[model samples]
Target: MNRRIRSIFWLMTICIIAINAFQGYWLWKTYQINRQQFASTVQSALFQSLEDQQVGDAKRLFIRKQKADSSSRMVIHRFDSMGSRHVRVFVNNRSDSISRIRIESEQPKRIVVTYDTQKRTTGANPLPADSIAKRISSLVLLDWTDRKRVNLAKLKAAYRSELIRRDIDATFQLDTLTSKPQNSLGNFVFYRNGDQLTTDDIIQTSPVPINPIQNLFVQATFAAPELYLLRQMGWLLGGSLLLLILTTGCFLFMLSTIMRQKKLSEVKSDFINNMTHELKTPIATVTAAVEALQNFGALNDPQRTQTYLAISQTNLQRLSDLVEKVLNLAVEEKRELVLHPEPVHLADVTNELITNHRLKATKPVIFDTSISQDAIVVVDRVHFGNALNNLIDNAIKYSRDKVTIQLSFRGNIDNWQLTVSDNGLGVPKAYQSAIFDRFFRVPTGNLHPVKGFGLGLAYVRQVVERHGGTITVQSEPGKGSEFTVHLIRRD
Candidate 1:
């Protein structure tokens, strides 16, 4: 059984470890995937943010040019009754050859013009116009070479907005850089900006061109990307951890229960063997004494007959006591052991038990007693006496040639204590805690020279607890053992 249990324990241990390892591998893969998705999302947002900034700048420039050119331009609009319109304009100013003209009315239209040095212009496809004229928007004179620093404040705002739009709530550091990074694309790259942002410190970095015409790009560096990822997968991580804890707890609980049951089975088997030996001795003795009286005609001699009868009665009594102890334990367990409590004098009981032990014990013994005569404690008299008797019986059975017993009963303000100490073969420290457990003996194996079914201490504990009391043992191997029973004082 022990070997089987050990095998099961090792197997379960390996299973638990494998489960943890697999879970750890799975989580790592998941983290990597989430990281990749995050980087991709950030890159997309950066590109979209650049486009948004460019559109805004271009619209502002166009609006400013239109307002400036509106005063010097010729306005033409032809509308039918159905609000359908065609616009045609000829600019009289011969500033530059017609380059680009954007016309905006109820609907936006672009009419690009081609011209000659004669200060005359014609549309690519004209609408019945005889002569040609030049029309140029104010944008034609502006220099494209003056590339100012990209609007960092505006870019940051747009970048953050785009990230939020994509469901990412992470903080970042943004800067415009003209020099391209020399590092490979997928690996972590360092961007040092006084804060010393290293590759390890950075979560992700996305570089996007500031504008279409410039070589400059905006770089966004995110710190602690893992924190964000953890928050995103909070529920999944939490649930997995909880399940792992519960699984380990259940495994430990099951293992402990198995071990406890195994111990119980061994103890019960020992109890059964001990009970059989105990029963056989008394039965054999009685049978022999009866046989002597019936077959050997011991009845013819009154003295011999009386001796046989006495021997038979004594053995019968031993058998009856053995059966009674077993039955009482069973009845107590089945019915939850109710106690009928009454006031009992502690001193009188102890004195009577001491006298009985002195008269009945076969070995040479010494009794030392300290009992409070005035101490009257509430307890079930019969059960309490039986409990004490079991303790005395055990002390004598377990001792060497000469046994010295100490019986002490004292009453405190809160409780009454009865202590039984003896110079017996004291129990080892390791087995003290288990001594009160049913069918648990200090010595292991099938047969023990000491009598009793290992029910004495168990019955004592049950009786004491049922009376709202407690029992404790203090023992040192070879020195001796002291058993104390504490009963609560009731007014």
Candidate 2:
């Protein structure tokens, strides 16, 4: 896939995975929290219920067994006091459940009783002695055979007796009394002077609820485990981001490398085509000149013979120059070329180059050397001479009528400048930048094109730069061109 699509795909995948992991962790934490809450609630309820049951049983034992006095004349009075104490203890300890205790003394003449309910103030008045005795007798006779019927009537009588004893004035009041299962403890309360007793069927509220602080602690403990998981997920996310950055960087590097290779391949192709044309032109010229010399009729005339010999020599030198330029370029490309620097007269070098190309010149050439006659530069003799010759030869080849070469020195003693200006067709402005590039030629559209591989100026530039120098061109369309070489003067 393309870079953008691939990046998006990985990003989406990472996001989805991260989201799922986070959600799963959250759900697991929530489940743990809920489970802890349920367990704590159940444990609290069981503990409260067990405590209430033990307290209720202890109160009943205190009333029925511990205070059962056998030899007391005021047995009823003592029993009544004991029952009130039992109720107080039951109320205090059994905070989670309802509890009550009643004690009745039976005598042939009178009946005495004391009762304590979990909740006081039943809103009633005291009952008569006969009615109170009857209620007590019914409770004492309670057994499995008629326990349900007797318990019901006993509770009703208790309510009437309590209302009469308390002397409650209200005409209408609620009576709430509840009976436990046959195997469980129950509580009873009377209202309206033992006229009625109300019983509740179910207890929905817990006697002792769970502590709020403990509940919060349990919740925090459950959440504590998730902290490490969250940290791990954060690390995973960070690693993914780093990986994404590295991958993007690698892709960009590969793309840049491919573009560079493509550009180099194009340059190599241009070099090959230009080299072939350059080599072929010199070979063709030499071959033609040799053929003219071999023809007996052309050699018969002294003038014609000399002309053919000179043409042959010129083409040979051109071929030799082409080979030398190629070899030098090869050495430079491999960074193996070395320069033999020596002091040389610039004027003598220029004159020798002119003499070498004199036969090949198609037009008359004029040399102007007005700046310095004894100008000496430390340079590689062979390469500098070749650079000067290449410029002069180009001027001669392109000029319509005459080629004018103006050589001058400029700058201070530390830095010297050698300038070669030619009055020939100027270089186009657009091609100036690439003119010295290997195998790059300006498109002149001349019907009879000048033979060149475009390597001459490139070679010249390489030589000048190697000598710690700079070369620049000044030209305008339809005007003459000037090439300037600046170098450090040898002390």
Candidate 3:
């Protein structure tokens, strides 16, 4: 089309592409950040839960180490040897004394037992040393095992609850595999099922191996973390999606506008070419006719001069009509089509156009008009007659030999229907819809037989619309075509 419009269109295209690309990039970055943040929050809560488990494990180990009864510690007064059946235990409570001592061991682990001198002198004879050692050792090991089970169950439950509170819903199995505790601050590191746990092997207790604490593992995993992040960013993601939709809509609208503008420019260009051809033909004919009258001394014979003069006048009138149609179209495009509505007879108007057509035809073409009644309509006489003439002229011009046209008036007094039918080479089904579009002519491939600048039906449709009427066509291929104009009859 035009250079300036083309430039603006290209600039808009680039802007749409660039903005979309930028938004895409921004969305990608936001996704990554959200994922990273979700991971960070999850890990932080996971490690904190692991630390809590470690503290619980430590507390269990301490409870196992102290075999004192709940009432008081089982302390030794003077016995302080690590030999068989003898051990020193601290008395943590001064006001009370231990009534019983519980010891637990699996196998091959030694157990030493001791008691206060006062309890030995209470008249209850002590059991045989070996039997006492074996029984207390087994009970201690049983108690420790039971407490271990309880503490482990609590730890697992706490771990799950902690994660849930942080919004991480994971399913896990307690890793049955076990290893000696690291005996250091790193004893609480968390591991998934398949992951590794690094440990340093320094001996923990200096005196004896009391509670052989080992690290237990709870391995967990959840579904997609990104999906979780998407849920978390509910309104944010929705707003972003809405923004994308709006952006896409704007892009499509701009593209559609540019394409329509380009199409209009092409149509206008064709109109200019066709207009130049139509105006030149009439002007050339008139010029030739006038030149002949001036140069050939045709005035010497009255009939010859009159014939040349008529030819000149006819061509000049045709030329003037073409120019006037163009000017009227321009004015209508600017929304300046003026109407001088007045009372007029529809039948008279139809008859006048038919009689004009008969007088203008070179070879005899059958033209007829039937007026049902002299119905009156309020319309601009000049433009309304011109609209009717255009429809009739197009019918004749596009027809084959033996051109027969009929004009008829129908309908009641309130509204009148004027139909013009012609036995022309009828319009194709494909081209009928677009016949009234400005500069849209039916394709006459290679022959160019039909003349006129494709403005006749368009002008007729516009003039009728300005007078508050409607026009339509009914036609079929190879059959005759009929144009019907409906206008309100004015009193």
Please give the lDDT score for candidate 3.
0.64
Off by over 4 Å in 1: 69-153, 175-191, 194-197, 211-217, 294-297, 409-413, 444-447, 486-491
- TM-score: model 1 vs. ground truth: 0.77
Best by lDDT: 1
Could you tell me every candidate's TM-score relative to the true structure? Answer: 0.77, 0.44, 0.57
2 or 3, which is superior by lDDT? 3
Candidate that beats the other on TM-score, 1 or 3, i.e. the better one: 1
Greater-TM-score candidate between 2 and 3? 3
Residue-pair clash count for candidate 2: 22
> For residues 1-491, what per-residue lDDT tens digits would candidate 2 score against the true structure?
24555575567557656755665676567556644553354334333333333234334443464246322111122212321211222212122322223322111112233443334243232223333334433433332123232122433343334434543211222222232224435332222223442333121112221111111000101223234333435655566556656655665566566555654565676667666777787688878877877866777788987887888788788889888877866777888447888878777887777677676666688877756557777889998888888877777776768778777777654588888888888888998888888767776543326776677898889889888899999987666788999998554
lDDT, candidates in the order shown = 0.72, 0.55, 0.64
Candidate 2 structure lDDT: 0.55
